[model samples]
Target: MLHNRVPHILKRLAAIVLLGLACVAAVHAQDVLRVSAIPDEAPTELQRKFAPLGKYLEKATGMKVKFVPVTDYAAVVESLATGKIDMAWLGGFTYVQSKLRTNGATIPIVQRQEDATFTSKFITANPKIKALTDLKGHTFVFGAPSSTSGHLMPRYFLLRAGIDPDRDFRTVAYSGAHDATAAFVQSGRADAGVLNASVWDKLVEQHKVDPDKVRVFAVTPPFYDYNWTVRGGLDPALRKTLTDAFLRLDPRNPEQKQILALQRTVKYIPTQPENYAGIEAAARTAGLIK
Candidate 1:
């Protein structure tokens, strides 16, 4: 009877052990990398741009990669703070908001080479608006209100030029995206508009907006703008893996080159919170932050 009881006990223990092992495998299977970006472009375009990069990230990290889309810039910041997402693509001003909202828990890990000196272009279809000063008494449009290149820095520069957008322009509008800002001006909805140079260059390169129909009104000087920020408590090892993957995107390789072109970057480099100091300062000065 004792020997029979021992075999039955052994069988029960083995079943428990197998259940634990299966649970571990299930947890590992659920370890997916969640990523998101600010809605700075049309949803479809952003999806198209991120497709190759997502595939590349999954292969590089040995984890399933998922792209979470947000409706607005603030949604990206909120998602990062609430831990609904693990990482995000954010503009400089949006990064500042996230850092503050998370009590400095968000980390900007990598930025494009061109991000070090990002610029905003003020474009217009109206021939009368040739310069910043000329925008007075005319309807003007800006990209998202929280945009570094499209709004905050552009507004800061406008104040520096003694042109208050709110007071100087007859009407001010938000186009919500760089491409839309160009369209607002081209369709005679607004006399002038501003957007990131990246999207502006893309529009020109793609002939999406005729150069003659919509021309640059003014170009802002260089400033730090966009970066890929991860949540504060992200695993260090995984963070390093993410950093290394972006750094490894070499333009010399054709496959990587296509990814870079889609991202509009020549290469990616390590970045830190300090790179966004001036952006924060500019936002504060522009009254976007209190």
Candidate 2:
């Protein structure tokens, strides 16, 4: 009888252990704040840029912050769509694509102050390519096909200027990244190329690319651009905490200043889906999204 009671006690202890494990598992499920950005810039540069921000987010959200790097623009969108990432830095076109992909389940929470009126630049080493019209019969490269500054808005402007990229250019190529677009034109891989003005400015600032070698020939009109967006089904409280953290990134603080400078923004501001209406319209007009 004592042996039988011992067996019952052992079964009871196992059940208690299993229940404790389940509770710990449930608590850990959302303990990590996994964030990623579109591969707009080089991977090394992106990592350098996100390092400070990741630390800042860890303090802000009280969760372990991790930067999940993606390989391309579409991967960012897909990651957000499938809940693979909690948040992402998305260009306007990519944001629209993600929102559409998830059936309007993503939220554009905040953006760099300049994103409200973002612009793109067309660059070239060929002196002959002086204007949008001069691009005729020349090889042209664009950033990722899903890029707002690199492709969609640039194409929209080119079309508006009566120069169809597909028909007018001798060749059309996708460099897949802004830095690569500048390199393509500077190295003569393409006669001309276009990239976001932010990247072009950064490259010039960093002396990474010679401005004289790959100079801007044209600039697209301003449009809505990049934003920090959260995936759908995120806990409303966590979403608010994240949004508040971004909104409250005070540049007066040294740590926050580093984060802002690395992000290439003076300050973060509240953003809404409505701000990107023009972007959605542009993607539709450019036939990038149905």
Best by lDDT: 1
Task: Note the clash tally of each candidate.
Answer: 0, 0
lDDT of 1 by residue, 1-290 (tens): 99879989999999999999999996785488899999989999999999999999999998899999988999999999998898999999999999999999999999999999999999988878788999999999999998888899999999989999999999999999998998898899998899999999999999899998889868999999999999988889999999999999999999999999999999998999999999999888888899
Residue-by-residue lDDT tens digits, candidate 2, 164-213: 98999999999989999998988899999999999999999999899867
TM match of model 1 to true structure: 0.91
Question: RMSD, each candidate, Å?
Answer: 3.5, 2.0
Scored by lDDT, model 1 comes in at: 0.93
Per-candidate TM-scores read: 0.91, 0.94
lDDT score, candidate 2: 0.92
- Where in model 1 is the C-alpha error above 4 Å? 1-26
How many angstroms is residue 4 displaced in model 2 relative to the true structure, after the best TM-score fit?
Answer: 9.6
The local lDDT score (0 to 100) that residue 161 gets in candidate 1 is: 92
Determine which window of 10 residues in candidate 1 has minimal summed lDDT.
25-34
